[model samples]
Target: MSAAADFAQDRDTLHFRGDLSLARLGSLPDQLDRFDGRVSRVDLSAVSRIDTVGAWVVHRFAARHNAQVEGLDEDSQMLFDHVVGAEQPVAQAPARPNGLIRFVAEVGAAAVQAGRTMYGLLGFLGATTIAFLNVIRHPSRFRFNATVQRFEVVGVSALGIVGLMSFLIGMVIAQQGAVQLAQFGAEVFTINLVGRLTFREMGVLMTAIMIAGRSGSAFAAQLGTMKLTEEIDAMRTIGVSPVEALVLPRVLAAVLMMPLLAFYSCMIALIGGGVLVWLDQGIPPATYIQRIREVVPITDLYIPLIKAPVFGAIIAVAGCFQGMLVESDAEQVGNRTTAAVVQAIFMVIVIDAFFAVFFTWVGWV
Candidate 1:
């Protein structure tokens, strides 16, 4: 075998001429080190029989020393090409604003968008309500099977999440009550706190928020996707009322499910709260039950239960309306889905506030 190496200082280059092989790998690094970091480039055009190991050694040596290599013959060049092409440069995207000013701007834009969406939603609700009234007068246009399916989606599918959240909320309230009451030797009062809080506020509030985030968003996305695909337009072309076919079913489903979910949540929360009280405060179930009996009035339970279906109606109407009003494309579907959840939560809270004030004024609280 013949092996030769030469250096050309004027050009800042090193030349390798050899039958390059695995055994040659060890000395290659030393040859590169002899340049003492002076040479900026390597020319390997005269190299022959360059194997994979030789190529890897050359590539690694050049990379480590921050030198560029070129001028390989065909066989050596193929190996060099594989080594060079294997490395991909990372691409970094431009940075976005991260300060408070950017946050305020984004929030402001979102608020404006929300306001516009609310207006569109109100219009859709009005139109759907009117169409439903018309359907009531006619009665033959409603599809019973489709309506049942919608009910199942809105009610049955939502039960587990609603029940689980309510149960945990109950547990939290009970634990909190137990902690406060224990200090005063009134640990038995945990049941009253759990029952009153769960029935009057947490039950309805948690149920509405859950439905808004889960079912409402799902409704908006489903309808928005349908609208984007022009399925709504096709329904209209077939002489089917889009409002009757889409909006009414979801609204009815939500209205039907909300009360059931609210009741479930209230019971679960109460049970959870009771468990916490029993475990932490040493309050027996009978004493806990008795305290709830004395403190929680019937009106408190009724108030939240009533609010649940109403909140459900709002969620259904708002979600369906936003979905139907969606314009543009798939991006709009996502934006509207988010909007549906926010609006549903906001409406639930606002309505709950109204109920609170009204109930207090009427001596229900």
Candidate 2:
């Protein structure tokens, strides 16, 4: 038979009878709700069998009515005592402070993370420097094949996209500059604008951005995958330095190829601008060339060329460092790859700004 509780109320006293187990707890709440005024005490002598559920009901009733409980045997008394003790109030959560305090706390956390990232970057840079020196000391130890392969991957394979992007950018700059300069009757200065901007800033900047998005992310993904597979650890076990074998080749390729790529980007941009000016302003190719020669000095080319290898090194290091940071998970590989590209692009822009300020102060531009 299922357990049941019979509650008979008389003024300030209530009587509990029958089985007082879980199967009968359902009716107890309804019967208790029907009671009026105060229940001073509950008599439980008639409960033939009592379980934890029944003890809980008695405990709740006792708490609600300030009622004294009586007539429980040893097992029932133990359960009733335990349930009463277990019904202690839950501690309230502490209230949150105002928004300004939370904002400051968040800013502090961000600053801490930024500091860690910078420290890790410096450590990776030092490791790469030592690896380069070691390779220089023993040229035979260097991975020539890997360097060449990365050069082809990062340079040759990137040509078409880089060309198209730079070309379109140049055409847009020419068209926009010509339209604005026309009001001042200085439309021919579009050639000067395109030449200076393309060679000195936009060409290399856009190229680095592209390479960061393409090659930097690829580096992180490749290295992260190797890390996940324990291949880098395997290389270490075999007395191979991953810095030299894996990182050096990619870094070297970026350093060697970046200047060449920047030069190509500048040339294609200038050509695109020339073509646009010829069509829009009826300026001949020779006239545009003469204007470039007259207005855009060779010194302008030096800035971008000087910046290229540094930017490439930043991209490569960011990618490789982030890849090395990856943990043993597929999701972490993707996250690190995305982080590498974002960090590379951000570093490239920051470095470019610093270089611009330094060059302006030193009379380089």
Candidate 3:
């Protein structure tokens, strides 16, 4: 039978009967309002069975009316006591601080997070340096095969896209600079502008940005996946230094490949600019070539070579650092990969700017 509640006005009692379980709770009184003032006692002698839900119902009714429960068997009373004992008030969260305090707190938290990220990147850089030193000390320990494989991926495979992008950028610079210089009857100077900019800054910067998007993100994703699957942890357990085996090869590969890539980029960009000038200004190829040779100094060529390896090292280190930071979450792979690209590009540009300032101070420009 379904459970029910009834008020016995004659005895000032609330009565429960039948199977008092969750399945039969619908048959109980819909409201306890009637028991508020009049009811002083509850009679549970006829309850055939009760569960936690049923016991809670009865307990609530009795508690509301300050009524005494009577005639429950030992089992029913125990169930009632257990259910009532388990009930607790839910705690509310504390209120947030108002206005400026909240804003300041958030800003402070962001600053702290940034500081931690900087500290972590610096630590990873140190570890990678130690790994590099170890490899240098024992050439036999160097992962030459792995480094060569990475070189193919980071350098050889990247040639087409980098070449295409550098070419387009060179054409744009030529078109814009030629149009402006034409006003001053100096349109021929486009060759000089293209040669110097491509070699000294644009070619290498573009290549670094591309490499950061490609190789850096790949490094982060690869390492982050290894981290997610506990492969990195397993390597540690087996006494394999992941930093030496994994990171050193990638960094070395970047260092080896970046200068070569940058040189290719500069050549392709200059070729693109030369083609554009010939087509647009009707300048002969021989004259353009001679002009570039005469106008662009050897120092411009050497500066990019110096910047390439440093930019490559920065990209590899930033990527690997973010990769090692991945927690056990799979979503973190994408996040860290994105972070790697952003960190590498940001650092690349900052370093490039600093180099510009230093070289300018030394009169290299």
Candidate 4:
């Protein structure tokens, strides 16, 4: 309970020893008042048994006089650091959340974020639709050259990848079908299976997936970069609508190219399937062609062809929307681009499911 504090002073330093108690807190202000803001350093290494109130007294004394204090014991130093550090205040250990509670909280947060994203997507879609309507009304302002360039980037650039994938898929389907059909003594039916599936589903789905990975990512990256650089804002500052200047051309290109790409994929897949059937199943080209003609009706071919453009539109719009939404730095561009592709593919599958149900109701499936 002793309040005695021994002190030694030099030109600029003050040294303290002995116990500092709570009762001396009132005098600390007076003690610092004598210094006249001139004391540069105070050393307190010799102090012992300081309580929380005593620590507060020391902290206030140092801060009010704007003098540096050193040589404090661990607890007092911690108190000093807490009062002086410019960073965030030190927090005591918090109780850990229960595992299930933590998980539910995380899920709820994710769901809220996802809902916001979906709302943003819907708004973008509405804006894009209005822009398209405007372009339709005033065709003179639409840049056909830019649209064509977008087509080349989205469509022509994807040809090699689409072709390779379709070919490999066709070969796999044909080989598998041939193996299974061999047991049924109907090896020639492999042609029909490969042809029908390739035309009806594989071609359109594979093309959409490929474009989602390629053109979708490109759109997001390009738009995200533009957004990051404020080029989108600059475009808005002028009379030009960003939707018309940026989105419309890309959307038009994707819609125009997807059907053609799907058709090309179908042809390549059929050819590859035919090759597999001819080599593995020992089916001649003419007989294989006859089997395909017998099994695959015109509706089967038309169904996927119709779905291709819709899938392409979904991918283009999703990519553009994600790009426009990016707010972080350049690193976020890749993340948004990935998100765009994944969402586009997911939408494609959902759309395909609807198409499947429709086709089934119409007796096409």
Winner by TM-score between candidate 3 and candidate 1: 3
Please give the lDDT score at residue 274 for candidate 4.
Answer: 88
* Model 1 regions lying over 4 Å from their true place: 1-115
Global local distance difference test of model 4:
0.86
Q: How accurate is candidate 3 locally (lDDT)?
A: 0.89
> TM-scores across all candidates?
0.69, 0.82, 0.80, 0.78
- lDDT value, residue 115 of candidate 4: 94
Ranking by TM-score: 2, 3, 4, 1
Between candidates 1 and 2, which one is better according to lDDT? 2
Worst 10 residues of 3 by lDDT: 1-10
lDDT of 4 by residue, 5-63 (tens): 55667877777766666655455546755756456778888786566666666666667
For all candidates in order, the CA lDDT equals 0.81, 0.92, 0.89, 0.86
Leading candidate by lDDT: 2
Candidate 2, lDDT over the whole model: 0.92
Q: Which stretches of candidate 4 lie over 4 Å from their true place?
A: 1-89
Residue 20 error, candidate 3, Å: 11
Q: Every model's Cα RMSD, please? A: 8.7, 5.6, 4.7, 8.3
Error of 3 at 207 (Å): 0.3
